[model samples]
Target: MTEKISIESNVMDERRTSGELEIKIFNQSDKTRTALKKLALWWGLSLISVLLPVVHFVLVPLFFFLGFFFAWKGFKSEGQVLDGKTTCPHCGNNIKVGKGELNWPVTEICQSCARVVRMEKKEA
Candidate 1:
């Protein structure tokens, strides 16, 4: 038996209740990873600056601070669903996608109103 728990957020409550199946792969995320990669690249080079302890004790602490700061910023920047807005065919109202990739243009339907709308195209 599958259970759904609603997670409250700024926009909507997202949940899914279904029997587990292998074939139905759902929404995939890529933003957090991209942010981490970007953060790693920047910190990898900047870390050397903090390693130098000559006449400065601030280097070590600064290094740690900047390192963590950058990492946090990176992870926070991505993974947020972009503005996935479209018209709800059933309600004739505005709709924005909070998650998921628009793979099949015609297949994506709104859960709230059973409204079918074209998938908002995005580059992977």
Candidate 2:
């Protein structure tokens, strides 16, 4: 499901800001699909590595194992941050939160002030 949500941003200097964001929460099927895609990508790389001369011995096994590992990781994902708009608490400049895996208390850098910004879902 997709929703417009409120988030809070903070800096180490005790600066805080609030912003609105759009996020997508993945369902079971979505997680399964993501897992499959990850598996396919890594496995494909493993297959291609077989054509390499000496590296095939290492790369093939590495990529093959990584496929299962990444698939398991993708299956555990809950949601993703699509995009968001926020203001830098330090420089008071607008910052755009780009697409990424949804992890609580996401940290970003302020382009204007070069300060680290921490973001999290606003508590109800």
Candidate 3:
């Protein structure tokens, strides 16, 4: 009879840092959309913040948080080359595959809830 042996290993990619969570960021189209959106939002919010004193106190913070959220989000929204598949985060409807052209934030909007869903990175 032949002897058999079993072995176990805890191998994982060393490139990934232990403390930091991995994330994927913008593509060419996504990067463009993000830049424009942030610019528009910043300018619009600046106007409101300057035009109204009382409201500015409240709105400025609101927009600041919003801006931060979008900026952070923009960095993670880069997606893989769209295949013929995507799903609506809101409605659960399947999205048809297509190429992006600087309209990622809007173009990828879920038709159901009209909310933006996560996009896969080319690496992910």
Question: Of the candidates shown, which would achieve the greatest TM-score relative to the real structure?
Answer: 2
Winner of 2 and 3 under TM-score:
2
TM-score per prediction, in order, is 0.29, 0.89, 0.38
lDDT tens digits by residue: candidate 1, 1-124: 1222222111122322111111122222344565466666656655666556673366655555676776665454423332344444455455545553223332346667764544422332
- Candidate ranking under TM-score, highest first, comes to 2, 3, 1
Runs with alpha carbons beyond 4 Å of true place in candidate 2? none
Write model 2 residue lDDT over 31-104, tens digit each, in one string. Answer: 99999999999999999999999999999999999999989988877788898988998888899999987777
Which tens-of-lDDT digit does each residue in 1-124 have in candidate 3?
1121121111122221111112223567766677568756865786678678678877877776777676656555544232234555445566544544223322345456665444432331
What's the lDDT for all of these models? 0.42, 0.88, 0.47
- Which of 1 and 2 is the better model by TM-score? 2
